[model samples]
Target: MGHQTETHVWDEELAPEPRGRTWRPEAGCPVEVALAAVSGRWTTLLLRELMGGPRGFTELRTLFPDLSAKVLSERLRTLRERGLVAVERRRGFPVRTRYELTRAGEALRVLLVELYATGEELLRLTTASETRDERSPGRLEA
Candidate 1:
Protein backbone atom coordinates (compact mmCIF):
# COMPACT_ATOMS: atom_id res chain seq x y z
CA MET A 1 0.00 0.00 0.00
CA GLY A 2 1.07 3.56 -0.72
CA HIS A 3 0.29 6.76 1.12
CA GLN A 4 0.53 10.50 0.46
CA THR A 5 3.22 12.60 2.13
CA GLU A 6 1.60 15.98 1.61
CA THR A 7 0.54 16.51 5.22
CA HIS A 8 2.54 19.55 6.34
CA VAL A 9 4.02 20.74 9.64
CA TRP A 10 6.16 23.86 10.15
CA ASP A 11 5.19 24.61 6.57
CA GLU A 12 7.01 21.51 5.34
CA GLU A 13 6.40 17.80 4.99
CA LEU A 14 8.16 16.26 7.99
CA ALA A 15 11.04 13.86 7.54
CA PRO A 16 10.06 10.20 7.45
CA GLU A 17 10.34 8.02 10.52
CA PRO A 18 13.88 7.16 11.77
CA ARG A 19 15.38 10.26 10.17
CA GLY A 20 16.66 13.20 12.16
CA ARG A 21 18.28 16.48 11.10
CA THR A 22 20.92 14.29 9.50
CA TRP A 23 20.90 10.75 8.12
CA ARG A 24 22.21 9.52 11.44
CA PRO A 25 20.22 10.17 14.61
CA GLU A 26 22.37 12.80 16.24
CA ALA A 27 22.43 14.19 19.75
CA GLY A 28 19.26 16.08 20.83
CA CYS A 29 17.12 13.91 18.56
CA PRO A 30 14.09 12.49 20.28
CA VAL A 31 14.99 8.97 19.16
CA GLU A 32 18.52 9.28 20.46
CA VAL A 33 17.34 10.66 23.80
CA ALA A 34 14.82 7.85 24.25
CA LEU A 35 17.37 5.20 23.28
CA ALA A 36 19.94 6.70 25.63
CA ALA A 37 17.42 6.52 28.45
CA VAL A 38 16.84 2.80 27.82
CA SER A 39 20.24 1.91 26.40
CA GLY A 40 21.83 -0.53 28.81
CA ARG A 41 20.77 -4.06 29.63
CA TRP A 42 18.46 -4.13 32.69
CA THR A 43 17.87 -0.39 32.27
CA THR A 44 14.32 -0.77 31.04
CA LEU A 45 13.55 -3.32 33.74
CA LEU A 46 14.94 -0.97 36.35
CA LEU A 47 12.74 1.78 34.98
CA ARG A 48 9.74 -0.54 35.09
CA GLU A 49 10.45 -1.33 38.71
CA LEU A 50 10.78 2.33 39.62
CA MET A 51 7.67 3.13 37.62
CA GLY A 52 5.62 1.25 40.19
CA GLY A 53 6.96 3.60 42.88
CA PRO A 54 10.07 4.51 44.78
CA ARG A 55 12.28 1.53 45.74
CA GLY A 56 15.25 1.17 48.03
CA PHE A 57 18.55 -0.34 46.92
CA THR A 58 17.92 -3.58 48.79
CA GLU A 59 14.47 -3.97 47.32
CA LEU A 60 15.84 -3.59 43.81
CA ARG A 61 18.43 -6.27 44.46
CA THR A 62 15.78 -8.61 45.80
CA LEU A 63 13.51 -7.95 42.87
CA PHE A 64 16.20 -8.80 40.32
CA PRO A 65 18.10 -11.71 41.77
CA ASP A 66 20.00 -12.39 38.56
CA LEU A 67 21.25 -8.79 38.29
CA SER A 68 24.44 -8.19 40.19
CA ALA A 69 24.60 -5.42 42.76
CA LYS A 70 27.38 -3.76 40.81
CA VAL A 71 25.39 -3.70 37.58
CA LEU A 72 22.26 -2.57 39.33
CA SER A 73 24.10 0.32 40.92
CA GLU A 74 25.62 1.28 37.60
CA ARG A 75 22.24 1.28 35.86
CA LEU A 76 20.71 3.44 38.54
CA ARG A 77 23.61 5.84 38.29
CA THR A 78 23.12 6.15 34.57
CA LEU A 79 19.41 6.77 34.95
CA ARG A 80 20.15 9.49 37.47
CA GLU A 81 22.65 11.07 35.12
CA ARG A 82 20.04 11.01 32.39
CA GLY A 83 17.56 12.74 34.68
CA LEU A 84 15.18 9.79 34.36
CA VAL A 85 15.58 8.69 37.98
CA ALA A 86 15.83 10.51 41.28
CA VAL A 87 17.54 9.29 44.41
CA GLU A 88 16.63 10.19 47.97
CA ARG A 89 18.67 9.47 51.05
CA ARG A 90 16.97 9.05 54.40
CA ARG A 91 19.12 9.58 57.45
CA GLY A 92 18.61 6.85 60.04
CA PHE A 93 20.52 4.22 61.99
CA PRO A 94 21.46 3.00 58.55
CA VAL A 95 21.21 5.71 55.93
CA ARG A 96 18.64 4.49 53.43
CA THR A 97 18.61 5.38 49.75
CA ARG A 98 15.52 5.18 47.58
CA TYR A 99 15.13 5.64 43.85
CA GLU A 100 12.16 7.18 42.10
CA LEU A 101 11.40 8.41 38.58
CA THR A 102 11.34 12.12 37.92
CA ARG A 103 8.53 13.85 36.08
CA ALA A 104 10.31 13.43 32.74
CA GLY A 105 11.04 9.83 33.65
CA GLU A 106 7.39 9.12 34.42
CA ALA A 107 6.63 10.09 30.82
CA LEU A 108 8.43 6.97 29.73
CA ARG A 109 5.45 4.91 30.90
CA VAL A 110 3.76 5.57 27.56
CA LEU A 111 6.94 4.71 25.71
CA LEU A 112 7.40 1.44 27.56
CA VAL A 113 3.80 0.46 26.93
CA GLU A 114 4.16 1.24 23.24
CA LEU A 115 7.45 -0.63 23.09
CA TYR A 116 5.80 -3.72 24.56
CA ALA A 117 2.95 -3.61 22.08
CA THR A 118 5.31 -2.99 19.17
CA GLY A 119 7.63 -5.79 20.29
CA GLU A 120 4.71 -8.22 20.40
CA GLU A 121 3.73 -7.27 16.88
CA LEU A 122 7.29 -7.66 15.66
CA LEU A 123 7.58 -11.08 17.29
CA ARG A 124 4.32 -12.18 15.70
CA LEU A 125 5.57 -11.06 12.30
CA THR A 126 8.86 -12.87 12.83
CA THR A 127 7.08 -16.09 13.77
CA ALA A 128 4.87 -15.82 10.71
CA SER A 129 7.90 -15.24 8.53
CA GLU A 130 9.64 -18.30 9.93
CA THR A 131 6.58 -20.44 9.21
CA ARG A 132 6.41 -19.14 5.66
CA ASP A 133 10.10 -19.81 5.16
CA GLU A 134 9.74 -23.36 6.44
CA ARG A 135 7.03 -24.07 3.83
CA SER A 136 8.85 -22.36 0.98
CA PRO A 137 9.65 -24.54 -2.03
CA GLY A 138 13.25 -25.84 -2.24
CA ARG A 139 14.01 -24.65 1.31
CA LEU A 140 16.37 -26.82 3.34
CA GLU A 141 17.18 -26.91 7.03
CA ALA A 142 20.39 -28.20 8.47
Candidate 2:
Protein backbone atom coordinates (compact mmCIF):
# COMPACT_ATOMS: atom_id res chain seq x y z
CA MET A 1 0.00 0.00 0.00
CA GLY A 2 1.84 3.10 -1.24
CA HIS A 3 -0.61 5.67 0.11
CA GLN A 4 -3.97 5.33 1.85
CA THR A 5 -6.68 7.96 2.27
CA GLU A 6 -9.78 7.70 4.50
CA THR A 7 -13.04 9.39 3.40
CA HIS A 8 -16.23 9.56 5.42
CA VAL A 9 -19.71 10.03 4.03
CA TRP A 10 -22.30 11.62 6.29
CA ASP A 11 -25.60 9.80 6.56
CA GLU A 12 -28.75 10.28 8.65
CA GLU A 13 -27.57 7.64 11.13
CA LEU A 14 -24.14 9.31 11.39
CA ALA A 15 -25.49 12.86 11.83
CA PRO A 16 -24.99 14.54 15.17
CA GLU A 17 -28.01 14.35 17.44
CA PRO A 18 -29.67 17.46 18.83
CA ARG A 19 -28.65 18.40 22.35
CA GLY A 20 -30.65 19.99 25.20
CA ARG A 21 -34.45 20.16 25.46
CA THR A 22 -36.19 20.48 22.11
CA TRP A 23 -38.70 23.34 22.12
CA ARG A 24 -41.02 22.88 19.19
CA PRO A 25 -44.76 23.58 19.40
CA GLU A 26 -46.43 20.41 18.23
CA ALA A 27 -50.09 20.37 17.14
CA GLY A 28 -51.04 18.54 20.36
CA CYS A 29 -49.58 21.11 22.74
CA PRO A 30 -52.36 22.81 24.70
CA VAL A 31 -50.42 25.96 25.64
CA GLU A 32 -49.25 26.55 22.07
CA VAL A 33 -52.75 25.91 20.69
CA ALA A 34 -54.32 28.27 23.23
CA LEU A 35 -51.82 31.03 22.43
CA ALA A 36 -52.44 30.62 18.72
CA ALA A 37 -56.20 30.91 19.32
CA VAL A 38 -55.83 34.11 21.35
CA SER A 39 -53.02 35.75 19.35
CA GLY A 40 -55.27 37.91 17.15
CA ARG A 41 -55.49 41.67 17.67
CA TRP A 42 -58.24 42.70 20.14
CA THR A 43 -58.71 39.02 21.03
CA THR A 44 -57.71 39.37 24.67
CA LEU A 45 -59.88 42.50 25.09
CA LEU A 46 -62.87 40.80 23.49
CA LEU A 47 -62.36 37.77 25.73
CA ARG A 48 -62.21 39.99 28.81
CA GLU A 49 -65.46 41.72 27.87
CA LEU A 50 -67.18 38.44 27.05
CA MET A 51 -66.08 37.01 30.39
CA GLY A 52 -68.40 39.49 32.13
CA GLY A 53 -71.50 38.43 30.14
CA PRO A 54 -73.04 38.21 26.71
CA ARG A 55 -72.82 41.30 24.50
CA GLY A 56 -74.46 42.33 21.26
CA PHE A 57 -72.59 43.66 18.22
CA THR A 58 -73.46 47.28 18.98
CA GLU A 59 -72.63 46.90 22.67
CA LEU A 60 -69.24 45.39 21.91
CA ARG A 61 -68.54 48.14 19.39
CA THR A 62 -69.40 50.77 22.03
CA LEU A 63 -66.86 49.25 24.45
CA PHE A 64 -64.08 49.72 21.86
CA PRO A 65 -64.67 53.31 20.79
CA ASP A 66 -61.82 53.41 18.28
CA LEU A 67 -62.31 49.96 16.68
CA SER A 68 -64.32 49.88 13.44
CA ALA A 69 -67.44 47.72 13.04
CA LYS A 70 -65.79 45.67 10.30
CA VAL A 71 -62.78 44.76 12.47
CA LEU A 72 -64.98 43.91 15.43
CA SER A 73 -67.09 41.66 13.24
CA GLU A 74 -63.98 39.90 12.01
CA ARG A 75 -62.65 39.40 15.53
CA LEU A 76 -65.95 38.00 16.70
CA ARG A 77 -65.98 35.63 13.72
CA THR A 78 -62.47 34.48 14.53
CA LEU A 79 -63.36 33.88 18.18
CA ARG A 80 -66.42 31.90 17.18
CA GLU A 81 -64.34 29.81 14.81
CA ARG A 82 -61.88 29.08 17.62
CA GLY A 83 -64.76 27.76 19.80
CA LEU A 84 -64.11 30.53 22.32
CA VAL A 85 -67.25 32.49 21.57
CA ALA A 86 -70.84 31.48 20.84
CA VAL A 87 -73.17 33.73 18.87
CA GLU A 88 -76.88 33.46 19.35
CA ARG A 89 -79.27 35.12 16.92
CA ARG A 90 -82.52 36.15 18.56
CA ARG A 91 -85.46 36.05 16.18
CA GLY A 92 -87.39 39.28 16.72
CA PHE A 93 -88.61 42.25 14.76
CA PRO A 94 -85.14 43.79 15.07
CA VAL A 95 -83.21 40.46 14.93
CA ARG A 96 -80.61 40.95 17.66
CA THR A 97 -77.45 38.83 17.96
CA ARG A 98 -75.53 38.16 21.18
CA TYR A 99 -71.96 36.90 21.68
CA GLU A 100 -70.93 35.06 24.80
CA LEU A 101 -67.77 33.30 25.95
CA THR A 102 -67.73 29.53 25.80
CA ARG A 103 -66.41 27.35 28.64
CA ALA A 104 -63.00 27.28 26.98
CA GLY A 105 -63.00 31.05 26.74
CA GLU A 106 -64.09 31.49 30.35
CA ALA A 107 -61.11 29.40 31.43
CA LEU A 108 -58.82 32.22 30.32
CA ARG A 109 -60.07 34.56 33.08
CA VAL A 110 -57.20 33.72 35.44
CA LEU A 111 -54.61 34.18 32.70
CA LEU A 112 -56.08 37.56 31.77
CA VAL A 113 -56.00 38.72 35.37
CA GLU A 114 -52.34 37.75 35.62
CA LEU A 115 -51.62 39.56 32.36
CA TYR A 116 -53.29 42.72 33.69
CA ALA A 117 -51.25 42.58 36.89
CA THR A 118 -48.04 42.09 34.91
CA GLY A 119 -48.91 45.10 32.74
CA GLU A 120 -49.53 47.25 35.81
CA GLU A 121 -46.19 46.24 37.31
CA LEU A 122 -44.41 47.00 34.03
CA LEU A 123 -46.06 50.44 33.83
CA ARG A 124 -45.10 51.20 37.42
CA LEU A 125 -41.47 50.26 36.78
CA THR A 126 -41.36 52.36 33.58
CA THR A 127 -42.79 55.41 35.34
CA ALA A 128 -40.39 55.01 38.24
CA SER A 129 -37.41 54.81 35.88
CA GLU A 130 -38.54 57.92 33.98
CA THR A 131 -38.93 59.88 37.24
CA ARG A 132 -35.49 58.79 38.46
CA ASP A 133 -33.93 59.82 35.14
CA GLU A 134 -35.60 63.24 35.27
CA ARG A 135 -34.30 63.86 38.81
CA SER A 136 -30.69 62.81 37.97
CA PRO A 137 -28.33 65.81 38.14
CA GLY A 138 -26.20 65.03 35.06
CA ARG A 139 -28.91 63.49 32.85
CA LEU A 140 -30.28 65.58 29.98
CA GLU A 141 -33.92 65.36 29.12
CA ALA A 142 -34.54 64.50 25.46
Candidate 3:
Protein backbone atom coordinates (compact mmCIF):
# COMPACT_ATOMS: atom_id res chain seq x y z
CA MET A 1 0.00 0.00 0.00
CA GLY A 2 1.12 3.55 -0.71
CA HIS A 3 1.76 6.00 2.10
CA GLN A 4 -0.99 8.51 2.79
CA THR A 5 0.27 12.02 3.54
CA GLU A 6 -3.01 13.61 4.71
CA THR A 7 -5.17 13.02 7.76
CA HIS A 8 -8.78 12.25 7.05
CA VAL A 9 -10.19 13.84 10.19
CA TRP A 10 -9.08 16.02 13.05
CA ASP A 11 -9.37 15.08 16.73
CA GLU A 12 -12.87 15.98 17.84
CA GLU A 13 -11.82 16.87 21.37
CA LEU A 14 -9.77 19.81 20.24
CA ALA A 15 -11.74 21.17 17.26
CA PRO A 16 -14.50 19.74 15.11
CA GLU A 17 -15.88 20.63 11.71
CA PRO A 18 -19.65 20.81 11.58
CA ARG A 19 -19.66 18.68 8.42
CA GLY A 20 -17.28 16.16 10.03
CA ARG A 21 -15.02 16.38 6.95
CA THR A 22 -13.74 19.37 4.99
CA TRP A 23 -11.11 20.37 2.43
CA ARG A 24 -11.15 24.13 2.86
CA PRO A 25 -8.37 26.00 4.62
CA GLU A 26 -8.98 27.16 8.17
CA ALA A 27 -7.43 30.64 8.40
CA GLY A 28 -4.10 29.30 7.18
CA CYS A 29 -1.66 31.45 5.18
CA PRO A 30 -1.91 31.09 1.39
CA VAL A 31 1.84 31.39 0.84
CA GLU A 32 2.37 28.52 3.25
CA VAL A 33 0.12 26.33 1.11
CA ALA A 34 1.89 27.31 -2.12
CA LEU A 35 5.30 26.71 -0.60
CA ALA A 36 4.23 23.29 0.61
CA ALA A 37 3.49 22.28 -2.97
CA VAL A 38 6.88 23.45 -4.26
CA SER A 39 9.18 23.49 -1.24
CA GLY A 40 12.31 21.52 -2.21
CA ARG A 41 15.37 23.40 -3.55
CA TRP A 42 15.36 21.47 -6.84
CA THR A 43 11.58 21.25 -7.36
CA THR A 44 11.27 24.47 -9.39
CA LEU A 45 14.14 23.57 -11.71
CA LEU A 46 12.88 20.01 -12.08
CA LEU A 47 9.49 21.30 -13.06
CA ARG A 48 11.09 23.62 -15.63
CA GLU A 49 12.97 20.68 -17.13
CA LEU A 50 9.87 18.52 -17.30
CA MET A 51 7.95 21.28 -19.04
CA GLY A 52 9.86 20.52 -22.22
CA GLY A 53 8.65 16.88 -22.51
CA PRO A 54 8.85 13.44 -21.00
CA ARG A 55 12.51 12.63 -20.36
CA GLY A 56 14.45 9.55 -19.37
CA PHE A 57 16.59 9.45 -16.23
CA THR A 58 19.78 9.75 -18.26
CA GLU A 59 18.38 12.79 -20.10
CA LEU A 60 17.53 14.49 -16.84
CA ARG A 61 20.92 13.65 -15.40
CA THR A 62 22.58 15.19 -18.46
CA LEU A 63 20.35 18.28 -18.25
CA PHE A 64 21.25 18.82 -14.59
CA PRO A 65 24.78 17.54 -14.41
CA ASP A 66 25.39 18.97 -10.93
CA LEU A 67 22.53 17.03 -9.26
CA SER A 68 23.46 13.72 -7.71
CA ALA A 69 21.50 10.59 -8.63
CA LYS A 70 20.20 10.32 -5.06
CA VAL A 71 18.88 13.89 -5.04
CA LEU A 72 17.29 13.47 -8.46
CA SER A 73 15.60 10.24 -7.38
CA GLU A 74 14.19 11.90 -4.27
CA ARG A 75 12.82 14.83 -6.23
CA LEU A 76 11.20 12.50 -8.77
CA ARG A 77 9.62 10.50 -5.97
CA THR A 78 8.32 13.66 -4.36
CA LEU A 79 6.77 14.85 -7.59
CA ARG A 80 5.17 11.45 -8.18
CA GLU A 81 3.75 11.42 -4.67
CA ARG A 82 2.25 14.87 -5.28
CA GLY A 83 0.50 13.67 -8.49
CA LEU A 84 2.46 16.13 -10.65
CA VAL A 85 4.15 13.32 -12.56
CA ALA A 86 3.19 9.88 -13.86
CA VAL A 87 5.46 6.92 -14.48
CA GLU A 88 4.84 4.39 -17.23
CA ARG A 89 6.43 1.00 -17.50
CA ARG A 90 7.92 0.32 -20.88
CA ARG A 91 7.35 -3.14 -22.38
CA GLY A 92 10.22 -4.73 -24.31
CA PHE A 93 13.22 -6.99 -23.96
CA PRO A 94 14.41 -4.77 -21.16
CA VAL A 95 11.67 -3.32 -18.98
CA ARG A 96 12.13 0.33 -18.06
CA THR A 97 10.12 3.30 -16.77
CA ARG A 98 9.48 6.73 -18.20
CA TYR A 99 8.27 9.88 -16.49
CA GLU A 100 5.82 12.41 -17.85
CA LEU A 101 4.05 15.46 -16.48
CA THR A 102 0.47 15.04 -15.38
CA ARG A 103 -2.24 17.48 -16.43
CA ALA A 104 -1.75 19.36 -13.18
CA GLY A 105 1.94 19.75 -14.02
CA GLU A 106 1.19 21.01 -17.52
CA ALA A 107 -1.00 23.72 -15.98
CA LEU A 108 2.03 25.21 -14.27
CA ARG A 109 3.91 25.93 -17.50
CA VAL A 110 2.36 29.32 -18.27
CA LEU A 111 2.76 30.51 -14.71
CA LEU A 112 6.40 29.41 -14.67
CA VAL A 113 7.08 31.25 -17.94
CA GLU A 114 5.61 34.46 -16.54
CA LEU A 115 7.64 34.09 -13.37
CA TYR A 116 10.85 33.62 -15.38
CA ALA A 117 10.11 36.74 -17.40
CA THR A 118 9.43 38.80 -14.27
CA GLY A 119 12.70 37.62 -12.73
CA GLU A 120 14.62 38.63 -15.85
CA GLU A 121 13.11 42.12 -15.78
CA LEU A 122 13.94 42.50 -12.09
CA LEU A 123 17.53 41.41 -12.75
CA ARG A 124 17.86 43.94 -15.56
CA LEU A 125 16.53 46.78 -13.39
CA THR A 126 18.79 45.86 -10.48
CA THR A 127 21.88 45.63 -12.69
CA ALA A 128 21.14 49.01 -14.28
CA SER A 129 20.65 50.66 -10.88
CA GLU A 130 23.88 49.16 -9.56
CA THR A 131 25.81 50.36 -12.62
CA ARG A 132 24.39 53.87 -12.27
CA ASP A 133 25.29 53.94 -8.56
CA GLU A 134 28.88 52.89 -9.36
CA ARG A 135 29.18 55.49 -12.14
CA SER A 136 27.93 58.32 -9.92
CA PRO A 137 29.16 57.95 -6.32
CA GLY A 138 26.80 60.54 -4.66
CA ARG A 139 23.85 60.09 -7.07
CA LEU A 140 22.30 57.13 -5.18
CA GLU A 141 20.81 57.64 -1.69
CA ALA A 142 21.23 54.67 0.65
Identify the candidate with maximal lDDT.
Answer: 1
lDDT of 2 by residue, 1-142 (tens): 6777645543535333332112576665565666777788898999989999999998999999998999999999999998889999999979999999989889888888988899999999999998998788998656
List the lowest-lDDT window of 10 residues for candidate 2.
13-22
lDDT (Cα) of model 2: 0.84
Model 1, TM vs. native: 0.83
Arranged by TM-score with the best first, the candidates are: 1, 2, 3
Per-residue lDDT, model 1, residue 69, is 95
Q: Which RMSD does model 3 reach against the true structure? A: 11.4
TM-score per candidate, chains pooled: 0.83, 0.71, 0.68
lDDT of 3 by residue, 23-142 (tens): 565334443444455669788898888888898877889989999999998999999998888888788967666789999888777767877899999999999988977898567465
Per-candidate clashes come to 0, 0, 0
Model 3, stretches more than 4 Å misplaced? 1-32, 91-95, 139-142
TM-score of 3: 0.68
lDDT of 2 at 99: 99
